[model samples]
Target: SVILFLNKVVISQVICKALLVPINPLFVCSRHIRNRYKRISASKMESATEPGESVAGKSTAMTAGQKKEDRMKRFRELHLKRNEARKLNHQEMVEEDKRLKLPSNWEAKKARMEWELQEGEKKNDCLARGEDYERVKLLEVSAEDAERWERKKKKKNPDPGFSGYAEAQLRQYHRLTKQIRPDMEEYEKQREACGEDFHPTTNSLIHGTHVPSKQGIDRMVEDVSEKQIEKRAKYSRRRAYNDDADIDYINERNAKFNKKAERFYGKYTAEIKQNLERGTAV
Candidate 1:
Protein backbone atom coordinates (compact mmCIF):
# COMPACT_ATOMS: atom_id res chain seq x y z
CA SER A 1 0.00 0.00 0.00
CA VAL A 2 2.91 2.36 0.65
CA ILE A 3 4.62 1.66 -2.77
CA LEU A 4 1.28 2.12 -4.63
CA PHE A 5 0.72 5.44 -2.81
CA LEU A 6 4.22 6.73 -3.78
CA ASN A 7 3.67 5.68 -7.46
CA LYS A 8 0.36 7.59 -7.53
CA VAL A 9 2.01 10.73 -6.07
CA VAL A 10 4.85 10.66 -8.68
CA ILE A 11 2.41 10.19 -11.59
CA SER A 12 0.13 13.06 -10.37
CA GLN A 13 3.17 15.40 -9.94
CA VAL A 14 4.33 14.64 -13.53
CA ILE A 15 0.81 15.29 -14.94
CA CYS A 16 0.56 18.53 -12.89
CA LYS A 17 3.95 19.73 -14.27
CA ALA A 18 2.82 19.04 -17.85
CA LEU A 19 -0.51 20.87 -17.31
CA LEU A 20 1.07 23.91 -15.57
CA VAL A 21 3.63 24.38 -18.39
CA PRO A 22 2.56 27.15 -20.84
CA ILE A 23 1.50 26.23 -24.46
CA ASN A 24 3.18 28.39 -27.17
CA PRO A 25 0.29 28.47 -29.76
CA LEU A 26 1.86 28.40 -33.28
CA PHE A 27 -0.03 30.22 -36.07
CA VAL A 28 -1.57 27.21 -37.89
CA CYS A 29 -4.86 25.93 -39.48
CA SER A 30 -8.28 25.52 -37.70
CA ARG A 31 -7.91 21.67 -37.62
CA HIS A 32 -4.65 22.00 -35.56
CA ILE A 33 -6.32 24.59 -33.30
CA ARG A 34 -9.35 22.40 -32.48
CA ASN A 35 -7.11 19.31 -31.87
CA ARG A 36 -4.70 21.30 -29.62
CA TYR A 37 -7.54 22.69 -27.39
CA LYS A 38 -9.25 19.21 -27.24
CA ARG A 39 -5.95 17.53 -26.10
CA ILE A 40 -5.42 20.15 -23.33
CA SER A 41 -9.06 19.77 -22.13
CA ALA A 42 -8.78 15.92 -22.18
CA SER A 43 -5.60 16.11 -20.03
CA LYS A 44 -7.38 18.51 -17.64
CA MET A 45 -10.31 16.07 -17.31
CA GLU A 46 -7.99 13.12 -16.66
CA SER A 47 -6.01 15.18 -14.10
CA ALA A 48 -9.27 16.29 -12.37
CA THR A 49 -10.34 12.67 -11.78
CA GLU A 50 -7.08 11.49 -9.96
CA PRO A 51 -5.16 14.64 -8.99
CA GLY A 52 -2.91 14.97 -5.89
CA GLU A 53 -2.07 18.66 -6.47
CA SER A 54 -4.56 20.98 -8.33
CA VAL A 55 -3.14 22.71 -11.55
CA ALA A 56 -3.89 26.34 -12.14
CA GLY A 57 -6.68 27.06 -14.70
CA LYS A 58 -5.67 27.14 -18.42
CA SER A 59 -5.41 30.77 -19.79
CA THR A 60 -7.18 30.61 -23.17
CA ALA A 61 -5.55 33.05 -25.63
CA MET A 62 -7.87 34.40 -28.41
CA THR A 63 -7.55 32.89 -31.91
CA ALA A 64 -6.98 34.99 -35.03
CA GLY A 65 -10.57 34.21 -36.32
CA GLN A 66 -12.19 35.38 -33.01
CA LYS A 67 -10.19 38.68 -33.09
CA LYS A 68 -11.21 39.30 -36.77
CA GLU A 69 -14.91 38.64 -35.97
CA ASP A 70 -14.86 41.12 -33.05
CA ARG A 71 -13.21 43.82 -35.27
CA MET A 72 -15.81 43.41 -38.11
CA LYS A 73 -18.72 43.53 -35.58
CA ARG A 74 -17.44 46.88 -34.21
CA PHE A 75 -17.01 48.29 -37.76
CA ARG A 76 -20.59 47.36 -38.76
CA GLU A 77 -22.00 48.97 -35.60
CA LEU A 78 -20.11 52.29 -36.22
CA HIS A 79 -20.92 52.62 -40.01
CA LEU A 80 -24.56 51.52 -39.69
CA LYS A 81 -25.26 54.08 -36.94
CA ARG A 82 -23.76 56.98 -39.02
CA ASN A 83 -25.57 55.95 -42.26
CA GLU A 84 -28.94 55.57 -40.47
CA ALA A 85 -28.65 59.09 -39.04
CA ARG A 86 -27.89 60.57 -42.49
CA LYS A 87 -30.90 58.79 -44.03
CA LEU A 88 -33.23 60.10 -41.30
CA ASN A 89 -31.98 63.70 -41.84
CA HIS A 90 -32.50 63.40 -45.62
CA GLN A 91 -36.12 62.22 -45.15
CA GLU A 92 -36.84 65.09 -42.68
CA MET A 93 -35.73 67.97 -45.00
CA VAL A 94 -38.55 69.51 -47.13
CA GLU A 95 -38.27 72.12 -49.98
CA GLU A 96 -41.11 74.70 -50.34
CA ASP A 97 -41.39 74.41 -54.16
CA LYS A 98 -41.50 70.59 -54.03
CA ARG A 99 -44.06 70.61 -51.21
CA LEU A 100 -46.35 73.06 -53.07
CA LYS A 101 -45.88 71.25 -56.43
CA LEU A 102 -45.16 74.52 -58.27
CA PRO A 103 -43.42 74.76 -61.67
CA SER A 104 -39.85 75.85 -60.87
CA ASN A 105 -39.14 79.00 -62.98
CA TRP A 106 -37.27 80.77 -60.18
CA GLU A 107 -34.08 81.22 -62.23
CA ALA A 108 -35.91 82.71 -65.28
CA LYS A 109 -38.15 85.00 -63.18
CA LYS A 110 -35.19 86.31 -61.16
CA ALA A 111 -33.16 87.02 -64.33
CA ARG A 112 -36.00 88.96 -66.02
CA MET A 113 -36.83 91.07 -62.91
CA GLU A 114 -33.12 91.81 -62.34
CA TRP A 115 -32.76 92.94 -65.98
CA GLU A 116 -35.80 95.25 -65.68
CA LEU A 117 -34.40 96.78 -62.46
CA GLN A 118 -31.01 97.41 -64.13
CA GLU A 119 -32.72 99.08 -67.12
CA GLY A 120 -34.77 101.32 -64.80
CA GLU A 121 -31.61 102.38 -62.94
CA LYS A 122 -29.84 103.15 -66.25
CA LYS A 123 -32.83 105.21 -67.44
CA ASN A 124 -32.85 107.19 -64.19
CA ASP A 125 -29.12 107.96 -64.55
CA CYS A 126 -29.62 109.05 -68.19
CA LEU A 127 -32.48 111.43 -67.21
CA ALA A 128 -30.33 112.96 -64.45
CA ARG A 129 -27.48 113.50 -66.96
CA GLY A 130 -29.92 115.19 -69.44
CA GLU A 131 -29.47 112.53 -72.16
CA ASP A 132 -32.19 110.83 -74.19
CA TYR A 133 -32.45 107.12 -73.21
CA GLU A 134 -32.51 105.06 -76.39
CA ARG A 135 -34.40 101.84 -75.61
CA VAL A 136 -31.66 99.21 -75.97
CA LYS A 137 -33.62 95.96 -75.68
CA LEU A 138 -31.81 92.61 -75.44
CA LEU A 139 -33.53 89.48 -74.08
CA GLU A 140 -31.41 87.39 -71.68
CA VAL A 141 -30.90 83.66 -72.27
CA SER A 142 -32.90 81.72 -69.64
CA ALA A 143 -34.86 78.49 -69.05
CA GLU A 144 -38.36 79.89 -69.81
CA ASP A 145 -36.99 82.54 -72.20
CA ALA A 146 -37.06 80.02 -75.08
CA GLU A 147 -40.87 80.22 -75.39
CA ARG A 148 -40.82 84.05 -75.21
CA TRP A 149 -38.13 84.27 -77.91
CA GLU A 150 -40.11 81.90 -80.16
CA ARG A 151 -43.26 84.07 -79.92
CA LYS A 152 -41.30 87.32 -80.58
CA LYS A 153 -39.49 85.77 -83.61
CA LYS A 154 -42.81 84.45 -85.03
CA LYS A 155 -44.47 87.90 -84.71
CA LYS A 156 -41.55 90.01 -86.00
CA ASN A 157 -40.26 87.83 -88.91
CA PRO A 158 -43.61 86.58 -90.24
CA ASP A 159 -43.60 84.20 -93.22
CA PRO A 160 -44.92 86.02 -96.30
CA GLY A 161 -47.16 83.81 -98.51
CA PHE A 162 -45.82 82.91 -101.98
CA SER A 163 -46.34 85.41 -104.85
CA GLY A 164 -45.45 85.17 -108.59
CA TYR A 165 -42.45 87.42 -107.87
CA ALA A 166 -39.73 87.03 -105.15
CA GLU A 167 -41.70 89.45 -102.86
CA ALA A 168 -38.41 90.60 -101.21
CA GLN A 169 -39.89 94.04 -100.48
CA LEU A 170 -42.07 92.48 -97.70
CA ARG A 171 -38.89 92.22 -95.55
CA GLN A 172 -38.36 95.38 -93.38
CA TYR A 173 -41.73 96.58 -94.82
CA HIS A 174 -43.26 96.19 -91.35
CA ARG A 175 -40.85 98.77 -89.89
CA LEU A 176 -41.84 101.30 -92.58
CA THR A 177 -45.57 100.46 -92.54
CA LYS A 178 -45.87 100.75 -88.73
CA GLN A 179 -46.37 104.52 -89.02
CA ILE A 180 -48.76 104.18 -92.04
CA ARG A 181 -52.52 104.03 -91.23
CA PRO A 182 -55.39 102.34 -93.12
CA ASP A 183 -57.10 104.41 -95.94
CA MET A 184 -60.60 102.80 -96.26
CA GLU A 185 -61.73 105.72 -98.53
CA GLU A 186 -59.01 105.02 -101.14
CA TYR A 187 -59.62 101.24 -100.97
CA GLU A 188 -63.39 101.68 -101.73
CA LYS A 189 -62.60 104.08 -104.61
CA GLN A 190 -60.22 101.48 -106.20
CA ARG A 191 -62.83 98.70 -105.72
CA GLU A 192 -65.45 100.82 -107.56
CA ALA A 193 -63.01 101.37 -110.50
CA CYS A 194 -62.59 97.57 -110.97
CA GLY A 195 -66.46 97.15 -111.27
CA GLU A 196 -68.01 93.61 -111.43
CA ASP A 197 -64.99 92.32 -113.42
CA PHE A 198 -62.83 92.73 -110.27
CA HIS A 199 -61.53 89.15 -110.55
CA PRO A 200 -60.15 89.54 -114.15
CA THR A 201 -59.12 86.48 -116.20
CA THR A 202 -56.64 86.63 -119.11
CA ASN A 203 -58.07 86.37 -122.82
CA SER A 204 -61.68 86.52 -121.46
CA LEU A 205 -62.51 89.83 -123.14
CA ILE A 206 -60.42 89.05 -126.26
CA HIS A 207 -62.39 85.82 -126.98
CA GLY A 208 -65.74 87.61 -126.22
CA THR A 209 -66.48 85.12 -123.39
CA HIS A 210 -66.79 88.37 -121.38
CA VAL A 211 -68.00 91.64 -122.98
CA PRO A 212 -65.03 93.27 -124.79
CA SER A 213 -64.24 96.96 -124.14
CA LYS A 214 -61.72 99.05 -126.13
CA GLN A 215 -60.81 101.01 -122.98
CA GLY A 216 -60.03 97.81 -120.95
CA ILE A 217 -57.88 96.33 -123.79
CA ASP A 218 -55.83 99.49 -124.08
CA ARG A 219 -55.39 99.63 -120.26
CA MET A 220 -54.19 96.02 -120.16
CA VAL A 221 -51.62 96.57 -122.93
CA GLU A 222 -50.34 99.72 -121.24
CA ASP A 223 -49.94 97.96 -117.82
CA VAL A 224 -47.99 95.03 -119.37
CA SER A 225 -45.52 97.37 -121.21
CA GLU A 226 -44.95 99.49 -118.04
CA LYS A 227 -44.09 96.37 -115.94
CA GLN A 228 -41.59 95.19 -118.62
CA ILE A 229 -39.87 98.59 -118.62
CA GLU A 230 -39.71 98.73 -114.80
CA LYS A 231 -38.15 95.22 -114.56
CA ARG A 232 -35.38 96.09 -117.06
CA ALA A 233 -34.56 99.34 -115.23
CA LYS A 234 -34.43 97.63 -111.82
CA TYR A 235 -31.63 95.08 -112.67
CA SER A 236 -29.50 97.17 -115.09
CA ARG A 237 -26.40 98.90 -113.67
CA ARG A 238 -23.59 100.83 -115.53
CA ARG A 239 -20.14 99.33 -114.60
CA ALA A 240 -17.15 101.17 -116.13
CA TYR A 241 -13.49 100.19 -115.45
CA ASN A 242 -10.87 103.06 -115.61
CA ASP A 243 -8.19 102.46 -118.30
CA ASP A 244 -5.88 105.10 -116.64
CA ALA A 245 -5.66 103.11 -113.36
CA ASP A 246 -2.33 101.21 -112.73
CA ILE A 247 -2.66 97.40 -113.21
CA ASP A 248 -0.45 95.94 -110.44
CA TYR A 249 -2.05 92.46 -110.10
CA ILE A 250 -2.65 89.36 -112.32
CA ASN A 251 -6.42 89.16 -111.82
CA GLU A 252 -9.27 90.50 -109.64
CA ARG A 253 -8.61 87.73 -107.03
CA ASN A 254 -4.83 88.46 -107.00
CA ALA A 255 -5.60 92.18 -106.70
CA LYS A 256 -7.73 91.60 -103.60
CA PHE A 257 -4.93 89.45 -101.97
CA ASN A 258 -2.22 92.08 -102.72
CA LYS A 259 -4.44 94.85 -101.27
CA LYS A 260 -4.89 92.83 -98.04
CA ALA A 261 -1.09 92.16 -97.67
CA GLU A 262 -0.23 95.81 -98.32
CA ARG A 263 -2.82 97.03 -95.80
CA PHE A 264 -1.35 94.77 -93.05
CA TYR A 265 2.46 95.26 -93.59
CA GLY A 266 2.82 98.47 -95.72
CA LYS A 267 3.88 100.81 -92.86
CA TYR A 268 6.45 98.37 -91.43
CA THR A 269 8.39 97.98 -94.77
CA ALA A 270 7.83 101.51 -96.16
CA GLU A 271 11.34 102.79 -95.17
CA ILE A 272 13.03 99.60 -96.36
CA LYS A 273 11.31 99.87 -99.77
CA GLN A 274 12.36 103.52 -100.03
CA ASN A 275 15.99 102.69 -99.16
CA LEU A 276 16.07 99.85 -101.73
CA GLU A 277 14.62 102.05 -104.44
CA ARG A 278 17.28 104.78 -103.73
CA GLY A 279 20.15 102.19 -104.00
CA THR A 280 21.20 102.82 -100.36
CA ALA A 281 20.19 99.34 -99.01
CA VAL A 282 23.02 97.12 -97.61
Candidate 2:
Protein backbone atom coordinates (compact mmCIF):
# COMPACT_ATOMS: atom_id res chain seq x y z
CA SER A 1 0.00 0.00 0.00
CA VAL A 2 3.01 2.40 0.67
CA ILE A 3 4.59 1.71 -2.76
CA LEU A 4 1.24 2.26 -4.57
CA PHE A 5 0.78 5.54 -2.70
CA LEU A 6 4.35 6.69 -3.61
CA ASN A 7 3.75 5.87 -7.41
CA LYS A 8 0.52 7.94 -7.45
CA VAL A 9 2.38 10.86 -5.83
CA VAL A 10 5.15 10.69 -8.51
CA ILE A 11 2.50 10.63 -11.34
CA SER A 12 0.76 13.69 -9.90
CA GLN A 13 4.07 15.70 -9.84
CA VAL A 14 4.83 14.73 -13.52
CA ILE A 15 1.34 15.94 -14.68
CA CYS A 16 1.83 19.25 -12.80
CA LYS A 17 5.31 19.79 -14.49
CA ALA A 18 3.72 19.15 -17.96
CA LEU A 19 0.99 21.74 -17.25
CA LEU A 20 3.67 24.33 -16.17
CA VAL A 21 5.58 24.05 -19.51
CA PRO A 22 4.41 26.10 -22.58
CA ILE A 23 3.45 24.29 -25.84
CA ASN A 24 2.02 25.23 -29.27
CA PRO A 25 -1.79 25.40 -29.18
CA LEU A 26 -3.70 23.06 -31.54
CA PHE A 27 -6.77 25.38 -31.50
CA VAL A 28 -7.90 28.66 -29.83
CA CYS A 29 -11.43 30.04 -29.24
CA SER A 30 -11.96 33.78 -29.94
CA ARG A 31 -14.76 33.84 -27.26
CA HIS A 32 -12.33 32.90 -24.51
CA ILE A 33 -10.81 36.48 -24.46
CA ARG A 34 -11.44 38.73 -21.43
CA ASN A 35 -14.24 41.34 -21.32
CA ARG A 36 -11.47 43.96 -20.99
CA TYR A 37 -10.11 43.01 -24.46
CA LYS A 38 -13.63 43.28 -25.93
CA ARG A 39 -14.03 46.72 -24.34
CA ILE A 40 -10.68 47.88 -25.84
CA SER A 41 -11.76 46.68 -29.33
CA ALA A 42 -15.09 48.50 -28.98
CA SER A 43 -13.27 51.71 -28.00
CA LYS A 44 -11.05 51.51 -31.12
CA MET A 45 -14.15 51.07 -33.33
CA GLU A 46 -15.79 54.15 -31.76
CA SER A 47 -12.70 56.30 -32.35
CA ALA A 48 -12.71 55.22 -36.03
CA THR A 49 -16.30 56.43 -36.46
CA GLU A 50 -17.20 59.91 -37.86
CA PRO A 51 -17.61 62.96 -35.59
CA GLY A 52 -21.05 63.23 -33.92
CA GLU A 53 -21.25 59.39 -33.95
CA SER A 54 -20.34 57.00 -31.07
CA VAL A 55 -20.58 53.21 -30.72
CA ALA A 56 -21.36 52.79 -26.99
CA GLY A 57 -21.83 56.35 -25.68
CA LYS A 58 -23.20 59.76 -26.69
CA SER A 59 -20.93 61.76 -29.04
CA THR A 60 -18.82 64.49 -27.40
CA ALA A 61 -18.75 66.53 -30.68
CA MET A 62 -21.15 69.32 -31.62
CA THR A 63 -24.86 68.48 -32.15
CA ALA A 64 -27.03 69.52 -35.14
CA GLY A 65 -28.05 72.70 -33.30
CA GLN A 66 -24.44 73.65 -32.63
CA LYS A 67 -23.53 72.99 -36.29
CA LYS A 68 -26.29 75.38 -37.44
CA GLU A 69 -25.05 78.06 -35.09
CA ASP A 70 -21.50 77.68 -36.42
CA ARG A 71 -22.72 77.98 -40.02
CA MET A 72 -24.66 81.17 -39.21
CA LYS A 73 -21.58 82.68 -37.61
CA ARG A 74 -19.53 81.97 -40.75
CA PHE A 75 -22.21 83.58 -42.97
CA ARG A 76 -22.30 86.70 -40.86
CA GLU A 77 -18.53 87.06 -41.03
CA LEU A 78 -18.49 86.65 -44.84
CA HIS A 79 -21.30 89.16 -45.36
CA LEU A 80 -19.53 91.73 -43.25
CA LYS A 81 -16.28 91.22 -45.17
CA ARG A 82 -17.90 91.50 -48.66
CA ASN A 83 -19.96 94.64 -47.90
CA GLU A 84 -17.39 96.97 -49.50
CA ALA A 85 -17.15 94.87 -52.66
CA ARG A 86 -20.95 95.04 -53.05
CA LYS A 87 -21.01 98.80 -52.62
CA LEU A 88 -18.18 99.36 -55.12
CA ASN A 89 -19.86 97.23 -57.80
CA HIS A 90 -23.17 99.06 -57.32
CA GLN A 91 -21.44 102.45 -57.64
CA GLU A 92 -19.71 101.38 -60.83
CA MET A 93 -22.99 100.27 -62.42
CA VAL A 94 -24.71 103.51 -61.53
CA GLU A 95 -21.84 105.62 -62.90
CA GLU A 96 -21.80 103.57 -66.14
CA ASP A 97 -25.53 104.09 -66.64
CA LYS A 98 -25.15 107.84 -66.04
CA ARG A 99 -22.30 108.10 -68.58
CA LEU A 100 -24.28 106.14 -71.21
CA LYS A 101 -27.36 108.35 -70.70
CA LEU A 102 -29.95 105.56 -71.04
CA PRO A 103 -33.36 106.75 -72.18
CA SER A 104 -36.66 106.33 -70.32
CA ASN A 105 -39.58 104.26 -71.69
CA TRP A 106 -41.49 107.40 -72.70
CA GLU A 107 -38.69 108.33 -75.11
CA ALA A 108 -40.16 105.78 -77.56
CA LYS A 109 -43.68 107.23 -77.34
CA LYS A 110 -43.14 109.65 -80.25
CA ALA A 111 -41.70 106.87 -82.43
CA ARG A 112 -44.76 104.75 -81.68
CA MET A 113 -46.94 107.66 -82.81
CA GLU A 114 -45.02 107.90 -86.07
CA TRP A 115 -45.44 104.15 -86.60
CA GLU A 116 -49.21 104.57 -86.17
CA LEU A 117 -49.23 107.32 -88.79
CA GLN A 118 -47.32 105.15 -91.27
CA GLU A 119 -49.84 102.35 -90.72
CA GLY A 120 -52.67 104.77 -91.46
CA GLU A 121 -51.00 105.87 -94.71
CA LYS A 122 -50.61 102.21 -95.72
CA LYS A 123 -54.31 101.58 -95.05
CA ASN A 124 -55.35 104.62 -97.12
CA ASP A 125 -53.10 103.53 -100.00
CA CYS A 126 -54.75 100.07 -99.91
CA LEU A 127 -58.26 101.63 -100.00
CA ALA A 128 -57.27 103.92 -102.88
CA ARG A 129 -55.99 100.90 -104.86
CA GLY A 130 -59.22 99.00 -104.26
CA GLU A 131 -61.32 101.99 -105.38
CA ASP A 132 -59.20 102.43 -108.53
CA TYR A 133 -59.58 98.72 -109.35
CA GLU A 134 -63.40 98.95 -108.96
CA ARG A 135 -63.57 102.09 -111.08
CA VAL A 136 -61.60 100.43 -113.91
CA LYS A 137 -63.80 97.33 -113.71
CA LEU A 138 -66.94 99.54 -113.91
CA LEU A 139 -65.58 101.54 -116.91
CA GLU A 140 -64.92 98.33 -118.86
CA VAL A 141 -68.70 97.76 -119.12
CA SER A 142 -71.89 99.75 -118.40
CA ALA A 143 -73.85 98.74 -115.30
CA GLU A 144 -76.92 97.88 -117.43
CA ASP A 145 -74.82 95.69 -119.78
CA ALA A 146 -73.28 93.86 -116.83
CA GLU A 147 -76.73 93.22 -115.38
CA ARG A 148 -78.11 91.95 -118.69
CA TRP A 149 -75.14 89.63 -119.24
CA GLU A 150 -75.37 88.24 -115.69
CA ARG A 151 -79.11 87.58 -116.13
CA LYS A 152 -78.55 85.78 -119.46
CA LYS A 153 -75.74 83.63 -117.98
CA LYS A 154 -77.91 82.64 -115.02
CA LYS A 155 -81.02 82.10 -117.19
CA LYS A 156 -79.12 79.52 -119.24
CA ASN A 157 -79.28 77.34 -116.07
CA PRO A 158 -82.05 79.24 -114.22
CA ASP A 159 -83.68 78.06 -110.99
CA PRO A 160 -86.53 79.52 -108.94
CA GLY A 161 -84.07 81.50 -106.69
CA PHE A 162 -82.37 83.75 -109.35
CA SER A 163 -82.23 87.25 -107.70
CA GLY A 164 -81.42 89.98 -110.28
CA TYR A 165 -78.83 92.86 -110.62
CA ALA A 166 -80.14 94.73 -107.54
CA GLU A 167 -79.34 91.69 -105.37
CA ALA A 168 -75.80 91.60 -106.88
CA GLN A 169 -75.26 95.34 -106.11
CA LEU A 170 -76.42 94.81 -102.52
CA ARG A 171 -73.94 91.91 -102.14
CA GLN A 172 -71.09 94.03 -103.57
CA TYR A 173 -71.82 96.91 -101.14
CA HIS A 174 -71.91 94.52 -98.16
CA ARG A 175 -68.53 93.02 -99.16
CA LEU A 176 -66.86 96.45 -99.62
CA THR A 177 -68.04 98.01 -96.32
CA LYS A 178 -66.09 96.97 -93.16
CA GLN A 179 -66.82 98.17 -89.62
CA ILE A 180 -64.89 101.36 -88.58
CA ARG A 181 -65.29 103.34 -85.35
CA PRO A 182 -66.18 107.08 -85.61
CA ASP A 183 -63.08 107.99 -83.53
CA MET A 184 -60.77 105.98 -85.87
CA GLU A 185 -62.23 107.87 -88.93
CA GLU A 186 -61.59 111.25 -87.30
CA TYR A 187 -58.04 110.22 -86.34
CA GLU A 188 -57.31 109.14 -89.89
CA LYS A 189 -58.62 112.41 -91.29
CA GLN A 190 -56.41 114.39 -88.86
CA ARG A 191 -53.41 112.27 -89.75
CA GLU A 192 -54.00 112.91 -93.49
CA ALA A 193 -54.27 116.69 -92.97
CA CYS A 194 -50.92 116.77 -91.05
CA GLY A 195 -49.06 115.79 -94.28
CA GLU A 196 -46.34 113.96 -92.32
CA ASP A 197 -44.15 111.35 -94.05
CA PHE A 198 -43.98 108.34 -91.71
CA HIS A 199 -42.16 105.31 -93.15
CA PRO A 200 -41.11 102.49 -90.77
CA THR A 201 -37.97 101.26 -92.56
CA THR A 202 -36.70 104.80 -93.20
CA ASN A 203 -36.91 105.72 -89.48
CA SER A 204 -34.30 104.13 -87.17
CA LEU A 205 -36.20 105.51 -84.16
CA ILE A 206 -39.17 103.20 -84.93
CA HIS A 207 -37.34 100.11 -83.51
CA GLY A 208 -36.31 100.78 -79.90
CA THR A 209 -33.09 99.39 -78.46
CA HIS A 210 -33.39 96.19 -76.48
CA VAL A 211 -32.67 96.41 -72.72
CA PRO A 212 -31.15 93.55 -70.68
CA SER A 213 -33.70 91.41 -68.83
CA LYS A 214 -31.71 91.18 -65.56
CA GLN A 215 -29.94 93.90 -63.60
CA GLY A 216 -26.88 91.56 -63.27
CA ILE A 217 -27.03 91.87 -59.47
CA ASP A 218 -27.53 88.14 -58.90
CA ARG A 219 -25.74 86.69 -61.94
CA MET A 220 -23.84 83.45 -61.40
CA VAL A 221 -20.06 83.64 -61.57
CA GLU A 222 -19.21 83.35 -65.26
CA ASP A 223 -17.92 79.96 -66.43
CA VAL A 224 -17.58 80.06 -70.22
CA SER A 225 -15.77 76.74 -70.84
CA GLU A 226 -15.81 73.11 -69.63
CA LYS A 227 -12.12 73.29 -68.71
CA GLN A 228 -12.82 76.39 -66.64
CA ILE A 229 -15.74 74.57 -65.01
CA GLU A 230 -13.48 71.66 -64.05
CA LYS A 231 -10.87 74.09 -62.78
CA ARG A 232 -13.59 75.79 -60.73
CA ALA A 233 -14.60 72.41 -59.30
CA LYS A 234 -10.99 71.74 -58.26
CA TYR A 235 -10.11 75.11 -56.75
CA SER A 236 -13.31 77.10 -56.03
CA ARG A 237 -12.88 77.50 -52.25
CA ARG A 238 -15.67 80.08 -52.12
CA ARG A 239 -19.06 78.49 -51.59
CA ALA A 240 -22.21 79.99 -53.17
CA TYR A 241 -25.62 80.30 -51.54
CA ASN A 242 -26.90 77.79 -54.11
CA ASP A 243 -25.81 74.17 -54.58
CA ASP A 244 -23.36 73.04 -57.28
CA ALA A 245 -26.00 70.63 -58.56
CA ASP A 246 -28.33 73.51 -59.60
CA ILE A 247 -25.50 75.33 -61.41
CA ASP A 248 -24.56 72.17 -63.32
CA TYR A 249 -28.19 71.62 -64.30
CA ILE A 250 -28.52 75.17 -65.66
CA ASN A 251 -25.29 74.85 -67.65
CA GLU A 252 -26.50 71.57 -69.17
CA ARG A 253 -29.85 73.13 -70.14
CA ASN A 254 -28.17 76.14 -71.79
CA ALA A 255 -25.88 73.80 -73.74
CA LYS A 256 -28.89 71.86 -74.99
CA PHE A 257 -30.70 75.00 -76.22
CA ASN A 258 -27.55 76.25 -78.00
CA LYS A 259 -27.11 72.84 -79.71
CA LYS A 260 -30.76 72.80 -80.80
CA ALA A 261 -30.54 76.30 -82.29
CA GLU A 262 -27.37 75.37 -84.18
CA ARG A 263 -29.05 72.29 -85.67
CA PHE A 264 -32.20 74.23 -86.66
CA TYR A 265 -30.22 77.01 -88.37
CA GLY A 266 -28.05 74.39 -90.14
CA LYS A 267 -31.13 72.66 -91.58
CA TYR A 268 -32.68 76.01 -92.52
CA THR A 269 -29.55 77.02 -94.46
CA ALA A 270 -29.40 73.62 -96.20
CA GLU A 271 -33.03 73.95 -97.29
CA ILE A 272 -32.33 77.45 -98.63
CA LYS A 273 -29.36 76.18 -100.69
CA GLN A 274 -31.45 73.31 -102.09
CA ASN A 275 -34.22 75.71 -103.08
CA LEU A 276 -31.69 77.94 -104.88
CA GLU A 277 -30.26 74.91 -106.73
CA ARG A 278 -33.73 73.85 -107.89
CA GLY A 279 -34.62 77.40 -109.11
CA THR A 280 -37.42 77.58 -106.50
CA ALA A 281 -38.37 80.79 -104.65
CA VAL A 282 -37.43 80.54 -100.94
Backbone collisions counted per model: 0, 0
Model 2: residues >4 Å from true position, as ranges?
A: 1-282
* Cα TM-score per model: 0.22, 0.16
Tens-place lDDT digits, model 2, residues 117-226: 97677667868777554455466788799999999998795322213457556764664355322456655664564445333355435244333234222232332255
> Can you tell me which runs of candidate 1 are displaced by over 4 Å?
1-92, 96-100, 135-282
What would the per-residue lDDT of candidate 1 be over residues 1-282, giving only the tens digit for each residue?
456545655665677678895333242234455776899999998888654333222222345567889999999999999999988777666454355665478668879999999989988997898877773333335646867878888889544332214354554365446845656776677567666655667743423444535865786577558864687579655445669955769997786676666656879988987898799998
TM-score of 2: 0.16
